[model samples]
Target: MISLVSLLVAAALVCLQSGYQAYAQIEGKNDLRDNLQPNIIPMPKKRALRPFINIAGPPPESARLIPGTLLELSCEVIGFPAPTAQWLKNGEPLTEFDDVNEIMNIHPTSLARLTSKMIVSSAANGDVYTCVATSGVKQQMASTTVVTVAGNDEESLFGLEALFRKPSKPIITEYYNEVFQEIGTSILLPCKHFSTSPSQVYWFDGDEKPVFGNPRMRILPTGDLLIPSLHWDDMGNYSCTVKNAYGKDTVETFLYPNKKQFFLVTVN
Candidate 1:
């Protein structure tokens, strides 16, 4: 009877061991199959970017005008994703101005441009207006075009018709005395001297008023004047004075507006 019990226990142990071996073999085959199988994740396709603005040619509405004489000052731009346009009156937002218009043109290829125009019936506010283009991607990614009205004493003339008189103070010059820019362009009036000592620089407009406080103009760290946008009245006399412990030296320059003056320069 004891031998019969012992034989039954041995037989049961052998059967359990065989079942576990078979299960292990099956699981190992499954893991091998999983590792050998190819997993392919599709990569996303890249989009073609729109052609950027060259800004090398004349803008859409490239005209010169005197103050309160323009029917309208047009600011135009080109971009993709159909950009939304806005305006500014003397560095202020479009909401303050009543006489303004916005026009948008869309292409079938998903590109677009905006033409923003404004009119000033009175000269009480200012002659400088701006056409600002808000980026389709971001508001900060933007640009501006200046629309200047003629000053009270200035004449309203087309870019070609407008004649710039020669500078009152002729050449004892170190730099270019004449800087002619388009109606809605920008230019830098450079002011520097070979002095090693620390010096102070001052800028003055044609009216003998200080240029430091103007909102439309900025003086860079290098004592250079940056006129980001140009208008009709922006044409005039500008002076840069540098003073040191030794003495003071001043240079005067004439900034003018023209239609194709710069184009001729690039061509030559």
Candidate 2:
């Protein structure tokens, strides 16, 4: 029979060789990667591996933007089991179906690339926004440097400057002069305004009467009009008028009910 000591020595040598092989394989892959350019996305590891995030794009740095304009904050997450992304404004989770927000997301593939986009209508100064990504139980966060409002004051600058000074005439930009929608579907007639003071937005019905007593219609804080769940009688010309202390503006859009599908036919 073989000696007991000799058998133990042989087993030790086998274990050492196996360990070295694993170490060499890992090191080799690292060396190869170091020699190549950065990848658009990280390689997907096995499902059993620990989850991690590689932020594709960092949040926007401190910047100046005009009021009544849209602000988009986005982030991309990559990991196993597929990570999910969401946004927080001033630490509050943003709502998707709210009046001022429309969210867009691109789901992850193999290695998992999840992208989150938030549209902030009429961004103001001193706004704090953050992006967060989560995979299972773990989470990663990205934040911005403060977005100060444009103007010259500590409390009343950037966002609410109109509250401190005399009001100026507002400028209005209409998205669509006319729109046709299928009955029972909601629509937003964008009426963007830039003004020295906060302006009042008034909407008139097809009969030229103020739009009130109808629970479905309302004006957004940004001066845009929202009419949820349209009906057949809702068809007619709608007027969007903005007024401040100094001046006023009007943008008219026609809403017609579409009972059938309309398509353009090309004849060659």
Best by lDDT: 2
lDDT per residue as tens, model 2, 1-268: 3322243357567656665666666667767899474323233222323445655555676544544344555565554434556567778876742422332221122124444555444444666777777666677888764564555554434344433354557656322344555566666665655555667888888888888565788877766677777778887878878898899978776666556433222111
Candidate 1's C-alpha runs over 4 A off are: 1-174, 260-268
Residue-wise C-alpha lDDT for candidate 1, range 17-38, written one tens digit per residue: 6656665666677677885744
Clashing residue pairs in candidate 2 are: 125-149, 149-158, 150-158
Every candidate's lDDT: 0.48, 0.57
Candidate 2 lDDT (Cα, 0 to 1): 0.57
